[model samples]
Target chain A: MTAETLLTWARGSAFDWAIGIFVFGMVLRLIEVLSLGKKPDLAEGRGSGVKGGLKTIVTRSIPRASVFAREPVRITNGYVFHVGFLLVLLFYGPHIEFIENLTGLSWPALPGGIIAGLGMITMASLVLALIFRLRNPVLRHISTVNDYLAWAVTLLPVLTGYLAYSHAVLPYTAMLALHILSIELLLVVAPFTKLTHMFSFALSRWYQGYQAGYRGIES
Target chain B: MSGPSVEKGINFIREQIDAPVASFFSSCVHCGMCAEACLFYTQTGDPRYTPIYKVEPMRRLWENEFTLWGRIKSTLGIAKKVTEEDFAQWEELVYDGCSLCGRCSLVCPVGNDISGMIRKIREGFSAAGYAPEGLIGATTRAITIGSPMGVRLPALKAQIGHVEKETGIEIPLDRAGAEYMVLLSSMEIMNFPEYLQAIARIMRQAGRTWTISSKAFEATNSGIQIGASDLARELVQRVVDAAEELGVQTVISPECGHAYTAIRWEGPNLIGRPFKFKVRHILEVLDEFREQGLIKTRGKEQARLTFHDPCQLVRKGGVVEQPRHLLDLVAENFVEMTDHGAMNWCCGGGGGVSANERADELRLKAFRQKKSQLDEIGVETLVTACANCRITLEEGLEEYEMDIPVVGLTETLAEHLVEEDQEGQG
Candidate 1:
């Protein structure tokens, strides 16, 4: 199929299928996870486990003191990439339009040049993070195939989004379609893959904090 | 049975991945901070010793069993299947390499509870019988001989008799309605009888009624160390039944780290019920006495002293501040290690590493991390609450040819106990 026809198909039925699968899978997987239910803590809690859990869900996002001292490069890049990804994903002009269309929610967008710059930086940090993972023997040893795959799938949308907007690579139409398609790929695989950390991170942090918190310790 | 099969091991792993496990697997950001937090990885630089990697087989099993895509990949033979060889190879990493110190759990950016997960995964390893032979022997003895060290009631009675005779203090046994039912680790009984002596002196001063249940004087749970909940529960039940029968208001876990964790924290969950009595570590009870001015030491140690926090006691048991508080009462020159308390380094022998004979070399190697920490502090004496850690610390110190003398915190306190007037003491 010509790029135009393929782009049309990917944006139409493929997007629909991807979104459907993504939503269903996410909800189902979340239900499966959240529903496993904890055994009652019969031991008298020294602290508020719920509060400790809530505290950790927030505190854990910031690296622990020892870790922060040991791993500056990795943690700094992580913060940058996450901030950039959230900004460009939620605040780009056409992205806002898409969100408005999807849910009638509209927001102001950053300027085109700024968004483009942020995307480039975000994508660069991701690439750098990938290289860091590959270069460190400890990281390389512990990493799974899914770790790299998740990183790549995550990077594509920003890269493609930047290209589509800047018209620096393929035709705008093709690049835009590819960006959307990449996002769909991420969405579809996310619930089933390590990307599930996005949702599970808070819950796990809470559970860990609660466990630690019951003993009056912040994890 | 030759002991340990892949199928049974995998089944245990399958049963262990509850919602928290699911959430932990899902939320892992692959940040590798857990590696830095793990002493095994930091000491050996082996990625397999990374805390999360220690639980990899179970994570893979969770994926294959629970996730749709993982199932598809498994059927297509693209995913690696866990095998007997995997468990055999991993036996060292799980038991000898990792101490289940909970440092990884504390530093996990996503709050994964890496050590707690390792503890759960141990259920599978134990089920498969892939655990170290030394731990198996200890667990067997713990159930069959009433103590992992094979000390029976006779040995305990003998030790108590010595303590009573030494101080002319009455050491009560099976005293119904006593305020405290004290428990002892096999290590304390065999290696550190001074602990018994300290407790006798401290309890008399505190004016608290305490007794040792000859029926359940053993405190350390071999099943906890080996990751057998059923066995741990059986072990915990002995103490529970003894304490309940005697109707003690509190049960005291002696100065052994995992004993404190097993009896105080994990006991309720393992036995599927909260104790009718509260569980307090020796340090906690002593600290309380200090606060009440019941424990008055005549003098403090003149030399530099530092505490070695047992991983289970500080990190898992949350008995962090009480140790420092108790130490403050007796150590005029007490110094904190660089990473003391909740984030303290393991003694390289906790979580049953000391029990497993095969782990001795690895345990010594891992002790270098603590050695380095202690060297930096340059303390004259090392004081710790756990008897198991004390023995391990002494062994490690001797192996390194370091001049540091390891002392039990309780005994240290006992040495400084004030000789009160010969009034009606108790």
Candidate 2:
């Protein structure tokens, strides 16, 4: 089949599947939150009341930003991995074009060279993180079979996407098909795993702020 | 560092502690989120002071000897041997940096119990004679003389006598058939004689028959603070035996934090049977007295005061509201500090930190947090129910040069106690 014809069919199916996965993922997340065990009571008294909480969230959270700024190599590697993953999901030219065609919204695309470079970097970083998780005793003890599975499932798309871009052993359409399938699997599983921490972290932080406030302390 | 016997003892106890508290010590993921919850880390901005760091020695042990990566690291010479330096470093990290405040456990998603792990590590150090000289000295005194402050039987009797002389009310001592037995720490007898006086006065005014046991008068359980369960049990058993001997209906723990937990909570368990007598903290008794109208305060409205909730008595014992209820009745201008009740910052002397000479820096650092909390409220006097908290906060205020007077809650109440003649007029 011609590249244009194959692309047209992939776009239509992928759009429907992505939307279905997104809606299902959100419902599962809501269920998980509702099913959580009873949260401890954390009410306290604070001097600034509401104003102090906001100031603390903004000011205190900044200097502590270095926590998220991993080591230099880790940061560089993480940037590449995250940027690549984001591009494939939201910024690849064809993906953007397909989304615009389907949903009537469009976004600027990254240059093809940058996109390809990011894909390689993402693959490298994922390998490094995986190695560390497996080799570090402390990390290994906390991890489960599901944790390894989740990492593999999340990384498959990036690896396959890069293969499709590089047009290695697998044909472009074949690699793209696997990439799309893995991305769909990840979306469905995201809310159920430790990955849900992304959303829960903000909620936990807010609860902490409220607790500090109740104690009559600046958050 | 050169003592082989000490080294062997340390190793043996470390092995035992590792076996006992393995679950808590091995569970940390090192996310460093707990750093923000620690007053030591918050004040010092030292990563070494973080609660996670306090548990790192145990974590390293678990990783090196108990896990695959540790084995590999050992083979590669990347993991260092546990040495005297490691124990010394861990001593400072655990004793100085941790107050066992349980805040980190609250924030931890995994429920790692960093505080519990640190306490167990302190137990290992204590067994090895590696504990700071001050804490070891206090524990030795407590074990030998039956009180951390080393006040003997005569001194305790003298203090009780002085209370009687001042109040013109006979303070009960060694009574054969008292219904309630009150236990006071030596700190109260030596420093805050008025607390003993107040308790005596309150017991007399309430008309409830109570006696102070000359044998187990000291309620300050240094064993609990130093992480020595056997020593703690020995201290608690004295009270248990006293209650049995006197045939008391209830045992009332004086205004000491660890004493309340030790006697009220662990006393029964350590005795290997449920305590037949009831266990009540002094604050709870005061609240009961107020509710029953057994004791009335006349000039309570004149004092401008704020309360400092000792972590053990308030947080661990769940006796927050009773003290506050009593404080509110006593102080007309009572203001709550920024941190009070369960969330209150440590007085900086808890968990044997006050007695640890090496913990001075971290103790002062922890106190700074409380100092700031007090400054925000602008209260001139801080009333705390715990004798340890009273001493710690007083020391803390002096260390910070804050000029805030720390008084016992009962002492504050006693200041406003209505005399028999005055009560009829009111």
Candidate 3:
């Protein structure tokens, strides 16, 4: 099909298929995880697990003082990509428009140039992360196909969006279509891959904080 | 592909897949940040020491059995199944390479409890009989002889007699209706009789009624170390039975890390009920005595010293501040390590690594992390609340030819305790 036709098909049918898979898959994954059920801690708690869980849900975004000193590059790069990716994804005009269309939610968008700058920064950060993963012996040893695949799919949308905006890699319609398709691929595979950490990270962090807090520790 | 023990191991791992374990495995993004937190990795620079990778057998079992994609992959025979060989490979990683220090759990960006998962993974290894020979022997002795180190009641009685003669104080045993029941570790009973003397002198000065239960005198739980809940429960039950029989209001855990955790933190849960008497670490009890103005001290040591926070006491048992407060009473020139308190590095022999003779070289190698911390401060002495940490630090210091002497925090405070005549003169 022509790029125009591809853009239309991507925007119409492919978007629905991707969103359906994303929603259903994430729900199933959550059920698979949460349904396992945590046993009640019979031990007396010295601190509040709920309070600790809430505190960690936000606090864990920042690295611990001791850990940050040892792995500054890894920690800083992690913040750069995550913060830049979320800012670009949530506040960029077109993406916000897409979300508004789907969920009837609206917010002020960041200026186009700022979002574009963030997109580039995020893409660079992701590339550096991949290089770090490939270079670090521990990362290289522990990483599986899942790790690299998660990195690639995460990087694709940012790269494609930049290319589409710049009209550099392909015709405008084709590049924009590819950008949308890249996101669709990410959503489709997210719940099945290590990318599932997007949701499970909060749960895992809360559990860790709760257990630690129950023991009266600030984790 | 499988043996009965391997089958049992897989089944145990399957049973261990609770929500936290499932969430931890699911949320791991393979960043390997936990390696930086683990001393085994940081000291040895071995990629295999990465904390998450240490639980590969459990992770594989979780993947193949739990998730939808994993189930599909398993049906297609594409997923890697947990094998007998995997257990053999991971036994060392789970038992020796890790101290269950909880630093990795604290440092995981995703908040995965990597150390907790390692603890759970040990259940499978032990079930499969892939545990270290030393740990197996300890477990057997703990179950049959009432002590992991095979220290029996007669030996404890002998040590009590020595302490009584040395301290000129009566040592009470099996005294019902005492306000406190104290437990001793075999390490303390055998290697450090001074800890008992400190307890006796401190108890005499505090004017508190305490007794050592002859029935459950051993505090160290090898069952907990070997990851056998049934055996740990039996051991804890003995303590509970003794404490209740004595009608003590509190049971003081000796200056041992794992014992405090096993009895205080994991005990109630292991025995399926709340403890009748509260469990306090010896440091905590001494701190309480200090707070009550019951135990008065006179002078401080002139030597520069630092406190070594035991992993189980600080991180697991929440006795972090007590040791510092108790140390403040006796240490005039106390210095803090770079990562002191809850975030402190382990002594490299916690979580039963000291008991496993096979891990001696690795344990010593991991001690480099502690050695560097000490070198940075250049302390003349190291005071710790855990008896096991005291011996481990002594060994590590001797191995490095470092001149720093290691002492228990309790004994240090006891040395400086105000005598009755000195108190009257003051």
lDDT of 1 by residue, B196-289 (tens): 9888888887788999998999999999989999999999999999999999999999998888888888889888888899998888898889
Worst-scoring 10-residue span by lDDT in model 2 chain A: A37-46
* Model 3 lDDT at residue B33: 87
The collision pairs in model 3 are none
lDDT of 3: 0.89
The residue-by-residue lDDT of candidate 3 on A1-219, one tens digit each, is 999999999999999999999999988888888899987777767898988887888888877788889889888999899999999999999989999988999999999999999999999899899999999999999989998889989999999999998888889999999999999999998999999899999999899888877778767
Alpha carbon lDDT of residue B158, candidate 3? 91
The best-first sequence of candidates by lDDT reads 3, 1, 2
**Best by the DockQ measure:** 3
Reference-based TM-score of each model: 0.96, 0.68, 0.98
| Interface RMSD to the true structure, each candidate | 1.4, 11.0, 1.0
Off by over 4 Å in 3: B421-426
For candidate 1, give the lDDT of residue A82: 91
Whole-model Cα lDDT of every candidate shown, in order? 0.86, 0.68, 0.89
Q: Order of candidates by TM-score, top first?
A: 3, 1, 2
Write candidate 3's Cα lDDT for B201-221 as tens digits: 888888899999999999999
What is the docking quality class of candidate 2? incorrect
Candidate 1 has a DockQ of 0.71
Q: What is the C-alpha RMSD of each candidate to the true structure, in Å?
A: 2.0, 10.6, 1.7
